[model samples]
Target: MKRLMFSVLPLMVGLALGQAVPASIPLTATATLMMPDGEAAGTATFTQAGNGVQVTVQVSGLAAGNHGMHVHEYGRCTPGVDAATNTIVPFGGAGGHFDPGMTGNHDSPQTDNMHGHGGDLPMLVVGADGTGRATFTTDKISLTGENGILKRSLVVHAMPDDYMSDPSGKSGARERCGVIERDSFETRNYPLPGPQDFPEGVAYDAVKDVLYTGSAANGTIYQIDAKTGNVIKFSDGGAQGRNSALGMKVDASGRLWVAGGASGSISILNGDGTPFKTLMTPRTPLPFINDLVLLPDGSAIVTDSSRPTLFQVTPELRVRKWLDLRDTPIEYQPGTNLNGIVALPDGSALLTIQSNTGILWHIDVASQQVTRVMDGLNNGDGLVLTGQTLYVVRNKDGVVSKVMLAADFKSGTLQINEPLRGLRFPATAVLVGDDLVVTQAQLDKRQKGAPETPFQLTRVKRF
Candidate 1:
């Protein structure tokens, strides 16, 4: 048995270097300001102009007076303990002003002195209505080079800058801050062969450099060349005794394992699309096998969405009922119950989601004990787990949620719900290198008899 080692450090490094602004191309960046208590302060935008840059800032919910603003060295805006007083300080993680030139002085924005810090900017004057706006251009800073502001922090101070103070402008305290991010990445789409393919699941074969997508409308499987973006039919659903294919994965031995949706079956095929075997479950309540994950020992754990049950298929192809959650806190609703599943790297436990109830549950493989981790993730259809970061694809919400789980997997924090462009109703995603290729499963449109032509799989980089 081989262990799954997941790490995102290399991917993070690639993204950081990829965001460096090219000298010939125009650049744009933005930041959403947040207050100490997690309130929306405003936004800031930066655009490349000539040899310098143009900056615009708009803010609200502040006292009617001047506020000092600057670009900080770090992109973090979380509260931190103050070293001087041992008290919590808001937005203290942003560190000090951005000073790439090693300058220790703070001067006017119009200053040409080398001692002036590059982060020194004009004051923001708030009106009686608690709103403020500032727009200016300066050659002291740029979108590229040593003084570039990408991946930095924008901060607003409690008091105004006197334009001559050293180190800091005597600007009482840091009131609000936002992390600056580039707006350069775009989603790339690859066309599927069928006009109404309605692909629900996607799996990448790193060994062959190919991608496989299963159709929800029909059980037809399509193979796509990852390098050339060419699509071809791999197997006919009807001929293969499959009604629908919802979730699928490729094991290390080059065998494809597919979860038969509403068919109560699991299909195993060779790398050449040759049928290996098919295992069927009881169809008392009309089982909906939504998704699955391959364990370190070559066995597979599958999720039955219509019931609060999980099925396991051993490496030798023996099938049996694995874990039943009927007596646990997880309830089986009228619609989808347990949809997506992922095993821990250590193969000690598994994390599964309840779509109807929006709850995440952790199950111990050896003990068969279930613990409800968290809720409020309604419509979470498929899940992609890398290290402690989990991505939940919400089909109805048309968004993908990024969550950071604790080391023990008993708790997690919802980071952000990002909406992907051209995502009709994303079903599931597979990580290919640093990109996430998501299936655009327009199930709603398919039921309405008006799905968009030539369904697509969108690739999102650094998601």
Candidate 2:
């Protein structure tokens, strides 16, 4: 009997001979439900499964009864004044039910055709303990495509759905709401022109929609079309006294500022790769100018890995040793002392990372005072600051750590370390849209022998 049932199952589901099965792509989203008083309720999750979507919901702190749950048009869960009642309503900003097909009818999840709302689902039943759990699959909704539910809201109504009513199944007020957000994970690689170029720094030109990368093996600057991924040599090797380009940035004047590693120089070039200016730093201490950050006032601050100092370029293009950490709380080690630098949003202070000791330092731009902020980031090579968040790229670890900095720049908490699979000695990164294009310098492989041919950059999304 079991064998007979198995044989007839394929026919029951309308399976055809030699039919190709669709591949299931990994896509997921989650939402945290909150009550009107900002109280925690429960959570809901959505996952792509075959040709359908799997939904799991767990709710608590509600009356023991049936409730209507659905996806709304907007992701907002804030309270707003209701037009009909002229009173403030909870989660009213979520708007109406999600109806991509503009269907005016409220029906069941098993409803055929596009006559019913896509967000309609089965009724949720709460137990005596005021807790409810549901797990189901529906073909009417999806995580992508025209009926994608990303950035939408999941609402739980006060009353159960009748499964056959106009508009919203006559469901009562929305008691709990949560915005569904996608879990982003995407990676791409763009090949460079040289076989052993060993690119170090990356910078993006938002206005021109192009990307620029520098070669550490030589001084060649490569320009890449952002949309097409086409590469072109912007400048030849050793151009404008740039023996090695370690860090780079494009200022507001559309000029590219290149950090000359070991050459103790800062080379400025026009957008067309013409020579603008080259400022040489103190050659004594064997200056290894590694990375730099442009300030809001058109000035720039660069980190020196070999020396215990940071070089600043004034708005008048004058170079000076802005802050020296020799007498400060930040202890500088022997190898690669400071690698990456970033200025805070308010321009009051700056942040730099030490590669050898893994200490993060905060410096006051006005007083030039330096203080230790955090540690345990050994091998931290590049730094990117967005608001109060800091992204630290650890070269040897092959991972980028996301850190949440305190408002006063006194402390920071490490969030998560996102690993790049094929990353080889990543030096620095620049934001392009919602992605991070990391320069894979491959310095470790270069030291061993002939590094990998045709060096490339890795583009990571949602890292």
Candidate 3:
């Protein structure tokens, strides 16, 4: 071995045994340095070692120079850098290097030479060609457990690592960064063990103790046996019916409400798969009907991003109230798209506002008042109320935070349950008493015009 010194230690090891692994974690990442600007992008691959990890990173497209690199306190890397200071700050609020021991001090190879802080790593050097590669290992990091490594972030510094510097690298600031999160074994192109196939849309039927999923590509609804994970196609709703059958909700009355996106219609089905009623949106008009939620008073709230309005619908499939985001005071800007809907126990509902603003709005059904609940969230997609705590899922950031519901829903506190890591574009969520039913929607951008595949449905039971 040449013993090349690089930063962002790679802890994942490549296995030649060929045995299938359930979860593969990202142990290493590489980055290139853009000269004056100090911008970069690269890929990191994580592998498993004995009871440890190994990582390999190859990054290119940089300004060409030595860039400081260190594992950050959070894994999410977005918006690039801090504009004012132009430094690398962790998304989860840079909590002193990843030192589980409460070390409180940054150690370099020379200065303290203690090898204490998880944020300490070798520097990455991007050559004149704007490329860099580094491979290293760290036994102090992991994906699971209270002392796991990735609960922090990996940041790229603007200057070269001095190796003997204290605290920060003296490398100016962090130009690029990415938060390390747990990798789900249920991804398609990513690969995992067991049966890696899924039908399509997921619906929870407590009475049946099974999950019903519809496949738009296959034009069939598969009833998945919960305990066994075996799937059997239950119904054929035709090509159009299957293609548009994206959102599904089971009301208290046991009626299954399906939103036919491509078909521009809503179909109400009996528990036995009988179609009781069908309501379609206009043809010549616009907007795709994305989500629907049946209220307690026999009313439904529907969302159409194309029209970009939340409409209150009657049981007879009539539009009763059209809630335009522009009219609402909850900061629904132009680019922000609305997604999931959940009706609270007190008749209020929370709507997902997918925007950089990261806002979750509370809507009072009786008064039609929209209150800004929380902010600083990216892709505020799924909202679910479990007991007195409300969990909001952020899509782009891959985080699920719990919000407390005090006397009035307005001035409550919020805290993140750091354990539930590795979530990308989390869409729908349901409360099975205290446990959460979360659906992971991973968009595969590898193939052009290809719909994302290999979605995951997870049941997160937190104590």
Q: Which 10 residues in a row give candidate 2 its minimum summed lDDT?
A: 1-10
Q: Which candidate is the best by TM-score?
A: 1
Model 2, C-alpha of 20: deviation from truth (Å) = 29
Better of 2 and 3 by TM-score: 2
Which residue runs of candidate 3 sit more than 4 Å off their true CA positions? 1-201, 214-220, 237-242, 282-285, 330-336, 348-356, 417-421, 444-455
By TM-score, the candidates rank as: 1, 2, 3
Q: Tens digit of lDDT per residue, candidate 3, span 58-128?
A: 66665688777766554444443443355654332433355543455566632221345555666777889
Error of 1 at 6 (Å): 44
lDDT of 2 by residue, 306-408 (tens): 8878888999999998877787887766788888888888788989999999899898998888778898988999888887888898887656777899989
TM-score to true structure, per model: 0.62, 0.60, 0.56
Q: Give stretches of model 1 more than 4 Å off.
A: 1-183
Error at 398, model 2, angstroms = 0.7
TM-score of 1: 0.62
